[model samples]
Target: MSDGERVEATPIDPPQPLGATGEWLASCREEVARVAAGFQAFEISDEAGYRDAKRQRAALRAEVASIEERRKSMTRAIELAVREFKDGAAEAVAPLSGLDAEYKERIDEWDEACRARRRDELEAAYAEMAPQLVTLVPFERLAGRYADAGKWFLRSTTGPKAMASLEEAVSDVARNERQIGMYGLAPEEAEAMRAEYFSTLDLQAAARHAMELREQRERVRALDAERAEAAGAPPAEESRAVASARRAAEAFIERDAQAPALEERQRYVFEFELSADELMSLMRFVRANGIHGRRRRAA
Candidate 1:
């Protein structure tokens, strides 16, 4: 009687929380309302407003599509730019001559400038289209916290412990963004940070280079195998000598072609003034030891 009476005296409220899809739908509805309001507010007599409304409607329709063609195009452009810069760097400094030095500097400067400019342009473009993009989805379903009050209530009811950590992570991102904006970093700095971030995500030029190198290595292995099959056995001394000479000639040609670009790249790396030699040495060590492939056994 005591427990039943106490429970009856204190009525429990039913839990109400918005799920991910619910949040998205809410956001989508909010976006549609906002856009509708904005369109309504436009002066009917003004030709500019009429044009703007038409353009915005078209953009909103595009946003309704699951795939964003414009964003995909921009991302592809950035990827291409990165690839071009990398290839240019690779081609600039093989022989390590003074001419190569100048070329290296020019290439590096141009590449860095291009990256900064491109990133800024992309950011601006995104900002202009953001409103339309928002309208494409319901707000509640955007896949982040703070979309609706129901999410908070749900978290509080179901997983109270995780609420603090989630809030902290969101706070951390906000703090970082605030710091970045406050610092007013140079375009070059911003671009560098962007590149670093993408690199961490395995989306950078170096990652592409690594893949290309692996493909080249595979081709070389295939050629070696084909040669072995055709030859059937070890060649006589004279033939072996001829094959050695041929290999040496090919190596010399390859080195000659690669030298200028490598030297230029080295100079650019050195310009950073951050122990470029040591870094290159480490890179070579990693390649020679196959560190990327497997862990080495202790000698």
Candidate 2:
């Protein structure tokens, strides 16, 4: 056809199918239903039962703390025993010190590993809980919308009435959007959902969240290792040993003092007097770090 006589080309068919809007809305509704189901399973409520669950969680945390404290005490005791054995003047203490040294080393190693594992477990739990929390409000709203829709559908009859009901359904859809908007869903989630409503079924955002959680878990694990090593070390008593050594050295200059030289007195201070304090400090440090002091062997 001549350019001037050419008919204007018909507009290319739209990329999406006819009725795509309705299909998208339907998919959104299904997602809303899925989320609602999950929330229902979660059994979340601001009721007395939820309060009781919180109390139970608190109690469990307290018990975990107690167990951790006991472990620290045990570690400290072992460290003290070792220090005393090493510095005690008597030959009888040497064997006991050796045993304590071995025990302390083993326990510290195990504690480090356990601390890492605990951190990982807690990280995973926190990550899982985060997404669920985000979904809660949206799901609740969706559940309410579905209920209203079901009620409206049952009593409606005429075309005008059905159109009114459809408008209500549109409002319900808008409400869902508003509810989810508060979560600040990752841009990717919004983009994917916008591109294809069916993409909501994919949990890529949740997986990304899980990966971030794992990174945090590893960071915590490394920190725990450093703290555990520091706690396991002999306390300030090492400095006290040197001070005692110096004092004993000066004693030789004063005839009336009659104290032995640094070498001889150093053993007495480190082994007999400071061991208990060193052990106590170590125990307190470990407990503060939330490391379980007790060795739990694999069954």
Candidate 3:
């Protein structure tokens, strides 16, 4: 956690300046030039250059160190600016996300309305057929009647009669089709009523299916909401604040981008001079603004 701790070794590169423009790179030009000049002064290329560099490697190292230090400052400053900008951007987009979610919920309600209406229409159609259905016997009832007849026909014979009753079996089944209706239904009407009964059953099934679908959708939405809350737990007001910060930063950044190079440098200096309160505001602004375009564009 120590700020001044040496953590890792890395290759040194020319440092760039931190700003909306390339001025940050320019600021560290002196450090880069000194390193380059040392390499050149020692003629560090072939046998002679290698020998000279090795002999004066200590001096070369000092120059390299200076360049590295300047590079780190530039990198650190730019990172801070970028971090701030993105935080602001995240805040700005949050409100828009909420609006988007509201619109989505409305769409879901509309879809459920359509499904509910369709389900009602099916049930209504089914209800209209109920009167006719009650008049006719169901297929199951007809089967049960046949089953009862079988019990009688398959009865164990008494002492005087030990044979199967063929007459009973044929008679029971002969009237099977006609017996499907409570009233004496003609073949065609009986078939039609049978179909209508099935249609009623189908409607009942469809209504149940629709209800299940609606319930499933509700469950999914609840799960999604829970996950979203757990991820950030951001309240409505907090989200709006982030959104507001993002927009402000974006607007400020746009204006700042148009300023002259000197004015841009002044803004960078202002970053250092920021108070704690101002720094937070700046972080939100810069984060929202999407600074550096390198680390934040993808985000």
Candidate 4:
């Protein structure tokens, strides 16, 4: 019969193509992620449930990471296909010509001010520690009595006694220096040593003072280099390390030329100049021989 028959149909969406820019693709991904997260087992109150949740979460995380990598690869072609544009480029460049050097100068001044403040704090702490410094009687003596003792040696039996006192003073000085070196090491006698008057107020204070002193030493190292140059001494030899770092940077820039859109975190990708296998072989080489500027410490 020509009578109308009941019919039902659900509409199916046509396959949509992604745009040339990654921005909209990113938005679409966020919505999909929101929907997926609604079913996640993110909470657990018992040990068994907690263990199960951990494994589930881990699997989900792995999937998420895989998706992120694929997404980057998919959008990379669009990023590469686009040409560079210079909208208002001259306007931006004209106002920023001299700012870099000016900012560097300002930063150096600020750093020096901070260093000066730290030095003052350390100096004040040292001043308090000076009064309680541990030492033998002769080592701490400001009078000329110890000096006279040396000359008085040939006068009588006091010669032997004077020699003994001098030896004692030398031993005391060595012991004090050794103890001072251990100030931050938390030796059993660290507190007891601090009581002697030569140490910083506490272990934490001692460590901070040591770090500041190290930084101060580095500042002097540059001056040392300048002075060495002035004196006509041979410049220090360049270490393999410095060369390695330079090479690493050059390698990165060279790779960037091939894939300017390559994210720093996504260094291993097929979109680069090399095939995945070739890239992986290069990676293995870098891992063993070291990258231009980076080296892993020997195990």
Kindly give the stretch of ten consecutive residues in candidate 1 with the minimal lDDT sum.
265-274
lDDT of 1 by residue, 1-299 (tens): 46456433456332222123355556667766775665443555788878887898777676555334544654566566667766765676445567778989999888677645543443344335444433332222322333243233232333333344334434443354344444344565545443442333222343345446555665665456445535653432333434444445456556656766553322111111112222233334334443343322123
lDDT head-to-head 2 vs 3, winner: 3
What do the candidate models score in CA lDDT, each in turn?
0.45, 0.48, 0.50, 0.49
Q: After superposition, how far is residue 296 of candidate 1 from its true place, in Å?
A: 42
TM-score of each: 0.15, 0.18, 0.29, 0.20
Give the winner by TM-score: 3
Name model 3 segments beyond 4 Å from true: 1-21, 41-52, 116-299
Of 2 and 3, the candidate ahead on TM-score is 3
Question: Which whole-number lDDT from 0 to 100 does residue 241 have in model 1?
Answer: 35
Q: How far is candidate 1 from the true structure (C-alpha RMSD, Å)?
A: 35.8
Give the CA lDDT, 0 to 100, for residue 268 in model 4: 39
CA lDDT, candidate 1, residue 292: 42
lDDT of 3 by residue, 1-299 (tens): 48788768566443232333366566567557756775555345689778766768778777778778867876787788778777876897899789999999999888677645543443343335443442353434432343344332222423112112223322343344334465444455556544543444332343345446555665666565446544644333334445565566567767767876563433222213322233344444454445543111111
lDDT (0-100) at residue 141 of candidate 4? 44
